[model samples]
Target: MASAETDSKSLFSLESYHVSEEHGFILPEPLEELPPYYKPWMDIALRVPELVHSHELRSHVNKMPLLSSTFLQKHRELRLAHLALSMMTMGYIWQEGEKNTAEILPQNLAVPYWEVSQRLGLPPIITHADAVLANWKKKDPDGPFNMQNLELLVRLPGGESVRGFFLVTLLVELAGVPAVRSIPTVINGVRCSDTEAVARGLEIISKSIEDMTDALRLMQVYVDPSVFYGIMRIYLSGWKDNPCMPKGLIYEGVQTEPMEYSGGSAAQSSLLHCFDELLGVKHEPKSASFLIRMRDYMPPLHKKLIQDISLQPSLRNFVQQQDCKDLNKAFDLCVTKLLALRSYHINVVSRFITVPAARARQLREQNHDSDGEIISRAPTALEERGTGGSGIMSFLKTVRDQTKDTLLPEASKEVKHHS
Candidate 1:
């Protein structure tokens, strides 16, 4: 455990962790392509969604040549490699939707994916890091940063919704830059008893949380609920905890025993973890166990940044000891904003997962067709689980309620009264 004095004395810099002052956790200039020798990955990765739709993805992936990870030297190159391999892995595993799942990842894909994942401190399966943070490229370098100008370098099974799901998430990370930039200010202010600076930083974070929620709203405009639940989702599912692959997947060349990993999840995003640590929000055991496990999925540096922020002198403690109403109020408002953001996340889950799940149930009950269209559509195994493997509604609601628990005594009373 790091002592508070040690944490305060050491300078915590975002750049040290590859977190940008202007882009937060979004990779600054992700390479869109790899070297010529890596053509197999890019060719198959770029065509995943199309190939899957045509039912040729598994065949193409099974035929892929074994490639070595030695040539990927640069950081961005490694990221692009991971993204490409991760996409190929997903398309390969879930090519025939969720029913006819592949149990063994062929040595051609498995060997390189395991190698790159080891080097990057990410799981061999697709993660939020691969799908969102390091997956974007602008249409024009000089153009303004907006949805219209942004696009994914690689795609998954869901066409427009896949593009929308990833790009919208990238924009939200982009919108969080100012808040990330202010983290040091908040910590330094707490260290020196500078209430005004702390308050100012908290306010910026509050507004950024609001902006993130606003950006999340675009999901409605970009991702169709039925499409997300029925089509794009299964491609994101991992072997672990999924009934489709009860024993987990075998990485052929890496290990004889099967390995398990969660699929792409918002929990893998470091932004919320950083905020939760900084705001002193303590989660109950259920949410905490799952969130803690998610850190293993993040880039090591990002996981370190969240851990270091947690060890810093508690901002909540500082505010409570202060004589400044502005400081206390600022802390309260920040927590309140985070609560709203989580609430909005639940709303998103409702539209994309919950509601669609209910409709799938209705359709299944009504259509006694022998073909089982409903089971084939979204995989009955995944309707209750979140993108990762946590219990969908309960996990989110527990997390949201935990955020509410972080409010100061008086603020808790007020928020509870209103809520």
Candidate 2:
């Protein structure tokens, strides 16, 4: 039995959370007119410890073995909590009521319900972004990022109640992905429960993932694999909760077999499965978001390798034209390496070389020491041959002859055997 003073102290403890100088938006007060169903959303969030960290929720759902309706129903207790977390986020930046411009109607300046109340008039709708920019201008016309204005805006009594600016930025960043754009819309009179909104958002995002199979697979090469894994986990969790749901089924239609896992930490073990099958990895409760994780795990060299492979005709056009067998094999190896690198390309390369370490040492024992670095200088023979006065035919013949020794080693051998 806690005393009334203790309750007051606990509630007040969160007041010191800072509203950064960058946060210009403010959440409207909680809606007094909120539907009864919305009560669970708000209360469950306050009651559930797991719901507080949205990232953790994503992580936990992903690591599960089989996400099915029964599992989700068991975790149904988390639904409202999930919604509460999302609603708090939405309150900060959801483009609502606003039309072409991003302005909150002055009369409709909805404060959080817990804050001071005034029956403000319903303002005209505008594009939320435009309204936000316009409002920022009105708030601080001359200031750029409006450091001071932003600082003041954040300090506004009721608006400063949620998490820091970083979380908002992270949400905004993810919202740009095509999958998020598919978030379902459920407009019911200017006020919807946060839980409902998040569910809709999640639904759309999950559907989008299902729709963009190829693109998502391509993204595996660019984004963090771990984050991809997390996103997949969320999708799986949703799917497990609703087995009939068509979410994350995009890859199922692709004529490819799913990859199997090798081993690693519970968080990263899925790397093995993802690399084995780029777009065909089966969903594991643990590493469903392996693609996201790969994106996060990618090193700078991985990007460089992808760029080089994409640019080099051998790898780039190979997929399109289906040419040279050796080049095709090399290109496949490159893709595997790109995915397997996860966080450290150097380590992947080192591990790759180990199988032939003795051969490599023997080769090194004879050749010039070229420390794991690729050489790209122009060939001296080409420069000398160009300088010599030779007819185009003769020059070309010379080139053909030289190429035979290097690039055309197999062809040269065939020619010798024929001779």
Candidate 3:
């Protein structure tokens, strides 16, 4: 038991880790030299926070082409990833409490964000980009990518206090790896009508989902209601004004103009979409659907590829066959695990955010001035976002509920009947 504890501690030891100056997820180049078109916005986003609300910034973003010729002319994929990361980072810091903003973001975070916002036809604002980019790091500059290290870094935020939320995030990232690895195999299997190969991919994804849920259960011990709420107050310090919980992160320039959308974050969770494609789960026709519109936020190439793969008659036929029970089971397992995680989050939000917000309101009411000039404590932006007063918790809960309804009983049952 002692040895197991030691091993676990060493696995998360930061002394063994370092930021990879080269070959890190974020490009090493300075923000000053990239995508001349986005520099103006970057300047305003980094320096003049108030300027983002003005029409000038919006006008500047409006005039830029959706896919800048410069982006198409260069390292398209890498550049797109960089831009997405930067915009998310800027949005994250822009809303962060004044105290956490002192560490001026390195160029690694600045350049690509501005460039990507131009490409995606959206203003450079805080979104799910921050959540995805927050965990990128490496033990050695030249080392291969390690998901364990990424998981460890995520736990560093609130330490033991907010370990549950960070642990869930880590498990989510870890879960996506096998899904990503199985992509090529699944695609190739469909192309060749190899049901066995497709089955193999499904097995891997199912096991990964199970593992993720198991990992999430460990969060129960680490999550103390009061402590977790306090930690969130610190983490969400920057997201007061922006209450929209982004659905996915946009990696590619797909739209001509910014549209009111969610699901950009879903793009990061590649496994969920991969399941939809393999099982022929169509969420598009449904109104206000959580996962359907996520495709709009994905890069054009990726979105197109997923669409093409889904359209393959062989894959759909295989999923519909009675012999594909194992594949169907695997798909169901993934959905169940995801729902479990969402349920866990909902409970945590209720305890940490919803309840506290209600109490804070009660306290304010009780403290009001007798003379009708109501004496009150002005809540900080972070406090407001943290306490569920900003509508973030409600938005998140609605998305989760919608997803739960959309997937369970109905979709799973349909797939089973077809099989």
Top lDDT prediction, candidate number: 1
Clashing residue pair totals per candidate (backbone < 3 A):
0, 52, 15
Q: How good is model 1 by TM-score?
A: 0.96
Across residues 317-389, which tens digit of lDDT does each residue of candidate 3 receive? 5555535666556545555565565667667557655665565566566864523321112233333443312
lDDT of each: 0.89, 0.25, 0.44
lDDT value for model 1: 0.89
Query: Which segments of candidate 3 are over 4 A away from where they belong?
Result: 1-116, 119-123, 129-135, 140-171, 187-193, 214-268, 282-300, 314-317, 324-328, 348-352, 368-419
TM-score of each predicted structure versus truth: 0.96, 0.19, 0.52
> What tens digits encode model 2's per-residue C-alpha lDDT throughout 162-252?
1122122222222223322221121110022223333343344334333323222323233332222211111111111122222211112
* lDDT, residue 231, model 2: 17
Give the Cα-based TM-score of candidate 2 against the true structure: 0.19
Worst 10 residues of 2 by lDDT: 114-123
